[model samples]
Target: MYQLPFTTVVESATSNTKKLELVVHPSVSSKFKRYLDIVGSLVGLLVLAILFIPIAIAIKIDSPGPIFFTQQRYGLQGRPFRIRKFRSMVTDAERLKSLVSNEANGLIFKNKNDFRVTKIGRFLRSTSLDELPQFWNVLVGEMSLVGTRPPTADEVMHYNQRHWQRLNVKPGLTGEWQVNGRSRVKDFEQIVDLDLQYQKKWYPLYDILLIAKTFYVIFGRIGAC
Candidate 1:
């Protein structure tokens, strides 16, 4: 793992007189984890390729916007990245955000009944198929198979110390929040706790377990979106 030069506050100023800039989670340097991400992302991309045509056609037929939605999101250590997903809402959804009521609390935002969702988008989210394009993010090494949920740029702006700690690991396609309650767990603080808990419980095998659980959660329709 490449360590950053001194850049943070006095909390990082140890006796060595060097400041620490970010959370240095052990998974960042795990060769095995990278190997798994490589193999899994390749396999996921293969699946995405097989399903892309149908999904794209469905989106085009059902909505006026582009097939994919791209947004700026905060990734590991507060870095910015363009996260992609199948477009599940109107193109002007961001502009209309204020009109929609946010049901979740804290820094995150959510509205289960958000009106911006199109008919086909509802199906995609319900089946979790809307997330397929993120396999590309994993292939490019911007994310992991199991890690914290990626936050929007706006969400990161409100983060304090504890919230920022969740950004230590790469974002994931499915994780603790995805499996635990996703929509059911509406509070951002609780999501932060879950992210930190995953860190404390992390290991290579633990990631595999989360992956398996992800399948169960998907099929069981435990937590959509």
Candidate 2:
């Protein structure tokens, strides 16, 4: 059993809305969760180390840029943190975002056939191998093994008060959104709804279930890419 942290209310000057931020303090279960994150992340990082060379070589052969993609993402309580992933797009992909047509609904961007994705990148994205580096984030406490997907600063800038609830807990490498429908889910509001639902019903067992489902989703390719 665990307790939902107290809520802290803050006024948003830009939107003139009150945002409820959950202030989670370390509890026994929370500490256990963190312990699991550390152990799991260590194992994950070992796997990443084994595959890093091959993936890096593939990226370099496919594109002329850094092998790792780093971006600022909102974490717990809307704090900014740098998130890392294997680069799966052309070097100029970010610059080209404005010119490309978005397939996703709401503030987030998604395009199944995005031209910016390199051949190797497409494969990596489909296999979710590009996200392997995020274990480091989990190991360092910037993320959890299971929680809401982190949002980009640009995406968070467009979020409504209710949408902000998702950031109450640490972001994750895989969560309800990843296991549910992923890119197939066109509506961003649905993703937020899932996040809020996860928050409301969070338990150690729930996290375990999500992690188990994630493996099936990935290996089965239910909604990959």
Candidate 3:
């Protein structure tokens, strides 16, 4: 494996070392990181701007509510950030969530034919068009073009210390789990494992590969919703 500029020691003389570990600065990959986020997001947002009009019209005709759905999710270092997505469910879906959450995988809540999903919601989710607003997050430096998926507050609370390493880099709009098997894979630990793989082996080339794979997955419409 390659080493970063600084060597991270587990502890100094005053404290006992639990396990020695190396920590890399997020800035190590800063240049390409910013480039991809800015350029890619800008292009993506432009495309979505063109596409959003039609989607918004469809959503409005299918349901009654605002055009967007904003929810709080944890970003790098467990920081709180609001993730924006097009509204895919009824306005009252959150209120009705608890009652219908019983069928969830215990870690992630998923229902293919969920009652909360509007006619347009199902298609948006299947096509992943609902996630287009996250490009705004990428443009603003809140997220990355490729990295670990951001976790919700509830998901973060359940995370263990080791799992926190996912926050070493900016969260992504698409990630290993999304491409690998999102709804099909329900093991939260396995998701963290994939995140750790990305963190430990991250490189500009790896990111490019993941991005290409993501595009394939998106257009292929595999493992979606």
The lowest-lDDT stretch of 10 consecutive residues in candidate 2 is 20-29
Q: For residues 1-225, what per-residue lDDT tens digits would candidate 3 score against the true structure? A: 432333233432322422223354353367977887899999999989899899999999999999999999877666678988999999999899876744445456777668999989999988889989999999988899888889886665655556666777788987788878866666777788777777667767777788888888878988876
Candidate 2, residue 69: Cα displacement in angstroms equals: 0.6
Full-model lDDT, candidate 1 = 0.83
lDDT of 3 at 102: 45
TM-score of 2: 0.90
Q: Give residue 166's error in model 1 in angstroms.
A: 0.4
Residue 93, candidate 2: alpha-carbon lDDT: 92
RMSD of candidate 1 to the truth, in angstroms, is: 5.2
Candidate 2 local lDDT, residue 215: 90
Clashing pairs in 3: none
Which segments of model 3 are wrong by more than 4 Å? 2-28, 102-106
TM-score of 3: 0.86
lDDT of 2 at 50: 99
Model 2 lDDT per residue over 1-225, tens place: 334555667775444545566565332248778888999899899999999999999999999999999999878877788988999999999889888898888978888888999999988988889989999999989999998889886787777667776877889888889989977887899999887777777776677888899999888888877
Model 3, residue 213: distance off in Å is 0.8
How well does candidate 1 match the true structure in TM-score terms?
0.90
